[model samples]
Target: MHAHFYAIVNQHAGNYRGYKIWQQIQEYMIQKDVRLSVLLSAYPGAPEDLAYDLASSLPDKESDVVVLAFGGDGTLHEVLNGLIEAKRHFPLPLAYIPAGSGNDFARGAGLKSASHWKQGLLDLLQTTHAQVINIGSYQLQENQPRRFFMNSFGIGFDGSVLKRANQSSYKNLLNHVGLGAISYLIAAVFTIFQTKGFPAKIHGLDLTKSYAKAYLMIVTNHPYFGGGIKVAPDAKLHESNLKFVLFQRHHLGQIIFDMLAIIFGGFQYHMKAVDNTLLTHDFTIEVNSGQTAQVDGKSIDQENYRVHFSKSSYPFWLPETINKKR
Candidate 1:
């Protein structure tokens, strides 16, 4: 276990739930006499800046240092990007605490904490070894720098939902009422009528084909997305393979069934799989038409681009009590 901690916290996330959780954690750390350095992010990209400068200034031989991120998947996403952008030769051990409404990454990564964080938090802080697991990486264009995502990638319908949800006034209202995750569902309902879907060309994966109207293209490294929904039931984080789940729309009736099933409950159980889903080592997706995109629940502004997906391993400072066997 690492003695020193570099914690990047977002106090305003999840309607100040991040701040509330931090209070509990801070008291625990003090009681245990653990050395903690707290950095609070005030705005959107603050965590990335804080993490980038921190990693850039750190020594290469510090085996006892762990950078702890205390926020949502998006915060973790920024922190990991910052560390990678620093161009360090050695990987910095990471520890994460889920403070967002839809902590799908935490669930997908087999983390012991989510709803029951009190005991789970203590277990992780006292964990013996850092758990090594596979993470995702992608590139938007040929010359563009590679970026990382923790959970899954989405394009078209789901991306539009996330993009809208992030900016919607009702989202804040829902958060105030402790229904923050339902924001995605509400946004998706709006997008369903506004969006007509888009076409895409698939390549690199063994079974490549053209998609007429890809209502949803979610390439997952694990089983969870949009809170606890198992969009890709067979996808596992420990494994190196990425599962591609695509939903094609033939008509309004077909897509209403496909998209609604995905939001309310698990999609895999409702639909029969034939050519819609594929699994491989890696794949390249090209969308010629304009559409929205999202990585790990955060919106990407780019439209009409090529993206490639692959996997790499990172050591997350987590408890061994996590289903290590999985």
Candidate 2:
């Protein structure tokens, strides 16, 4: 039986879904046998800091302690990165309850139970074992510390659309109404046609290409992105290989078809405009200057940056679900 639980919560996630759920369940959790400590995040990066401190505070072999995260994928992303930064000799187990709009992490990680997080937490409370999932990491510059992601990373159109959706005031309204995904749809519709496209050079996984007008390039460790879209069907949680999928707008008609194929499914694999490559070893992706980038749904500013990609590991103490464990 676990003796203690450390909960890192991002209340603002899913437009207060995380906080609202936690508030309703905290009393019940406190009454349970396990000791519980809670930390609320005030802003971005707070969860990461809280996760680091919690991991550092635990003993190396503290098997009875588990860190529980309650938020969307972005919150989970920070918590995992924080644990990685702590650099503990042994991995610390984590449990998650996804309460965000685009729960791509939950979708990919086989935690659909998160939709009803109260039950999800209840199920997790009974689990005694944790499964270790291999995650993804990247570096914008050589010799720099690695940044990790559990879902996927994208540059060019994929990222630009997310940036616009996340920054738009309509996102707040949509999130408030539990229709946040609509923002992504609206943004995508406008971004695709407006994009002039950018250049890129990709090298790794026995597949190399240089594109003069790469509309979108994404590296995914799992199959789901953009709230449930199968962005890279070959990518899976248990698999060690990453899928680097790229798209080029050689012609307006062809580019529209590519985007439609991606959104509606089927024919993407056969399209000449789409390049889906399996990345087995370390890879380098150089994008055109002043491009927007995204990792696990967070925006980034990368200009002519050559990002390095690799692998990492995180131990997840998740409740068993119908989906295969990763």
State model 1's lDDT. Answer: 0.76
Give the alpha-carbon lDDT of every model: 0.76, 0.81
Give candidates' CA RMSD values in order: 2.2, 1.9
Each candidate structure's TM-score, on Cα atoms with residue i matched to residue i, is 0.91, 0.94
Candidate 1 Cα errors over 4 Å, as ranges: 112-115, 205-207, 263-279
Give the per-residue lDDT digits (tens) of candidate 2, residues 150-192. 9889988878888898889888888776777678878888887
Residue 40 deviation, candidate 1, in Å?
Answer: 1.2
Best by TM-score: 2
Query: Considering only N, C-alpha and C atoms within 3 Å, which residue pairs clash in candidate 1?
Result: none
After the best TM-score superposition of candidate 1, give how far the Cα of residue 92 lies from its true spot, in angstroms. 1.4
Q: Write the per-residue lDDT of candidate 1 for residues 18-123, one digit (tens) a residue.
A: 6786888888787888888999999989999998998889886647778888877788889888877887777677888887767788887667543466776777
The clash numbers for all candidates, in the given order, read 0, 0
